[model samples]
Target: MIFSRKIPLYEFFPKEFVDIHSHLLPGIDDGAKSMEESLDLIQGLIQMGFTRLITTPHIYGSVWPNTPEIIRSKAILLQEEIQSRKLPVSLSFAAEYMLDEKFMQYLDTSSLLTIKNKYVLIEFPNFQAPLQLHEILFRLNSMGYEPILAHPERYTYFENVINNIEELKEIGCLFQLNLLSLAKHYGTNVYETAIKLLKAGVIDFVGTDVHRKYHLDTLKKITSKKHLKLLETPFKNNFNLW
Candidate 1:
């Protein structure tokens, strides 16, 4: 199906829309607290017309301690539930890995999860970026893993240092913006940065980054033509992931 740019935000989603990042996996991170909440959130996304979701649970260190095996197991359980209900949705799983020592260990030793074959979804600390952020990205590129940096606009450090963001783009890092950031859900700074990134045509993709119902609720309010116009440039490759 073809999507026209004139669609309103609330009705923006259609069956072809594939959300590449979300935290609907139950009990895995700071996302949905239980299976019930997870299913509810999935249902809400379906209601909003999202038929395909790559629900990414946090794989932070011992805080969440989610390994690939654990994520696969949990993902299977959720898929089964969705099937039992006969919901018209396609659920898949990857992970939003935090850039830290633990992530490096995974990168060095184990098979890290991917949004697709070689595309990994990653996030930086909200407070600051890792000291060896460039080195880490270089290593990923060398190893043939395409790192999709999630929600680049939400990071406080990048808010004032636009050069850092540009350098990332120059070095082959793909940027994913949180949809809520466009609605000022994070803050004015994030909203402005998201707009700037989109307007600059630096953002490669967009996702819900939804941790709870509040996020989904806020996403529904993104009705401005300006915002929708900006979003038109992104998520263009989301369907290709399938």
Candidate 2:
């Protein structure tokens, strides 16, 4: 099939962009290490034409183990820093939750950070999806939260199981493809998968998932017209629908 659907994309990045996923928070998870580095990364994203950012640090129970209070405190500090520097960007914080057994505690308490409205960003294990993945998503839905599966293309286990991805949406899960995946930053398989999802129009949103300047560098180098065209739909939907 010839891909004829198009969203208005600019010569560079679209101005209507609101990067819903990133790891710009310093000393948090595997993202930026220090406050200075965080500011620098945010600045680079701003230069790329992103007007707003919802930086999502990992909230794995065993690893990052971040709490909502801790995330909010850091966000307040970062917002002050941005103001001090007058970055002219809207900054917010949310957690990229690992959807696992440990996550039940949060669900039990109904304590979770939202990206917008009832939407929450979640990441599944790359090795294999949980046996009860659908049930978990159902639980989230029952709690009045919608899950946006972060970087679905990077999940190698389901590379050949395209219908499994469709099943995710059947219950409740929107797919968020990483922008770097299109640049082959994750690998060729991820790039191919991202393209497949884009062509299928299965990807609902896109993000830099910018862990470092290297990510920004790769994104900046995505100057090919074909590549940029593939990005237009996600960008437009993220800005308008979200």
State residue 38's C-alpha deviation in candidate 1, in Å: 0.9
Task: Give the clash count for each candidate.
Answer: 0, 0
lDDT, candidate 2, 24-64, per-residue tens: 88897899999999999988888778878988899997889
Error of 2 at 235 (Å): 1.2
Best by lDDT: 1
Q: Local distance difference test, per candidate?
A: 0.86, 0.83
C-alpha TM-scores of all predictions: 0.94, 0.92
Clashes of 2: 0
